[model samples]
Target: MLYWLMKYVLLGPVLRLLWPTRVTGTENIPENGGAIIASNHLAVADSFFMPLHVRRMVTFPAKQEYFTEKGVKGRLKKWFFSGLGQIPIDRSGGSAAQAALDTAIRVLRDGHLLGIYPEGTRSPDGRLYKGKTGVARVALEADVPVVPVAMIGTDKVNPIGSKMWWPRRLEIRFGAPLDFSRYDGLVGDRFVERSIADEIMYSLMELSGQEYVDIYAARAKELAAADAAGVRPAVPAQPSAPVAGDAARVPESKAS
Candidate 1:
């Protein structure tokens, strides 16, 4: 009820008027089944604009800090996100990471549209970054389709480090759902997971028309921050093998 009230009556109208997102390919979304909406992380506004344009409720894994903060403002943040059906997640690695993944699987199994940023964090620059394999693991475990979603122009509306929003042209594009049924029996294989993650990122790159950086977005941010501080950043270790295969062969989509 709260979600409906806020979306339709309270905030939706205002947001739609302010941003007026142009959406396409919503026909690709399944009417009643669970699926992962894998989107590129560009800005904070990606969360709000994506949900605003979609018909179904999108459950995203939010950083645990949002729900753990104190004071009236913190309380309000918790209330708003909770009411929007976001699941609190601990980004710290180890058991907490596994726990967050488990929660996401449960949501998918229960037949909900799960929204995830495969890049893990927003791009420090406006380019797309390499995706984490967590998305692939969850899709395999929960047995759901992965739909590539492109959120365009959100970075302008809510750029990084900007405290307020600006009215900007926004668009949300949904690509055709990707099926990984060919790799159905191989869940725990890291190579298979990496392949899937790369494929998702490839689709996002094509849809959003953003330059693809092979490095992780978080690491890129760290390196960028280090440069700004006049400090040298440590070189990241290379992966065991190159990231290539079917993902590379996937055809690019026509961006609007």
Candidate 2:
């Protein structure tokens, strides 16, 4: 297959030699079975180096724009990512979220590795942002352990707006699998989902040794862009008291 050839034959040899990439805790990965590898997104290279070091082919859902672009350059990008076996996701709204979970469930059911960036997008700065609940949803739905992976120094390899790769020391550290089986029956609870996502992000913060930011990465980016545009960002509204019939009333993972 193209993935096998790329990992073992073509690109693998070249990458391992050129960049100072090191992967640890690979033994933590189950040899077989569906598991979610929740990693911190630092740079574009995080996608490439993470899979390059792992023996098993780790597949993740990528934004569809990468595959749908036109022209020669676009064609090459599409073919390369498709050949790498990544799923193309719409990333539009709720429908895309459901579709992603559906695809992820199928991938997990097929006993393949699923790589996910809980932060949703790469960090604008090096700090780790609050993880989206989608990752927790996938793990709970698939009934698999969530492994926290920290990608170190990848930002230096491919810094923001830099097209060329720099020969920098990088590492991929995988932590012990996080079991969220306790919240299986309560996945629908938004608070429980938030707790689970926060727990995963906490583990990533420890693993990656990056400063933790409570705000979501997307929000941070939006605020940064607004600042660049000389426009003030609106303040987020506070949450009201829990509704009478809310299931989240029951305390879970990190409700506080």
Candidate 3:
């Protein structure tokens, strides 16, 4: 298959020789069932390095643009990504979020590994950001375990806006699978979802040893852009205080 050829035959050897990756905690991956691989978003290479180290085929819900671009180069990109088994989800329209959630559930129901970045976007400054509740929703709906993964040094090798990857050592650390079975039948409760999301982020914070920012990464990037342009950006109000259950799940020290 294309995925095998690319990972094992074409790109795998090249990456192994150049980057020399070290991965740990792969045993945390469930062998016979669907599970969510929740990872910190550092660089675009995070996608490649994570999949290359894991034995199973990990499918991610990528943006639609990756599959719809035009021109020869675009076609090649489409082929490469498609061969890797990425599902495209449209990021527009009122129903876009629901569609992507459905796709994620379907992937899990079929007994496959689904990779997701709960932060929604890559960290702008190498710090972990607040996680979206979508990951919590999917985990609860699909009844699958969520494994927190940390990719270190990927950003240096493939910095944002860099076309070619530089040779560097890469380290991936996988934390134990988090079971949210206690929250069963509590899906759709916003408070419950927030608690779950915070717990996942807390686990990543401990595993990655990155400062946890209370705000979303996308908003942080916007603020940075505004500062660069010398424009005063309207500061959004802080998020509401977490519920009591959330406090227990995510310690105050880590979040601050």
All models: lDDT? 0.85, 0.83, 0.87
Cα lDDT tens digits for candidate 2, 145-248: 98889999999989989999999878889999888887767667778777778788878878887877778889988988887788966323331221222134
Q: Pick the candidate with the highest lDDT.
A: 3
Off by over 4 Å in 3: 233-256
lDDT by residue for model 1 (1-256), tens: 8777778988889999988888999999988879999999889878877887789998999999999989999999998888776889998889999999999999999999999999999988788888999999999999999999999998898989998999988889999999987777778777678888988988898889888777888888888888778896643443322243355433233110
lDDT by residue (185-239, candidate 3, tens digit) is 8788776788888888888988888877788888989988897898866334443
Worst 10 residues of 3 by lDDT: 236-245
**Candidate 1, run of 10 with poorest lDDT:** 247-256
Which runs of model 1 end up more than 4 angstroms from their true locations?
233-256
Clashes of each: 0, 0, 0
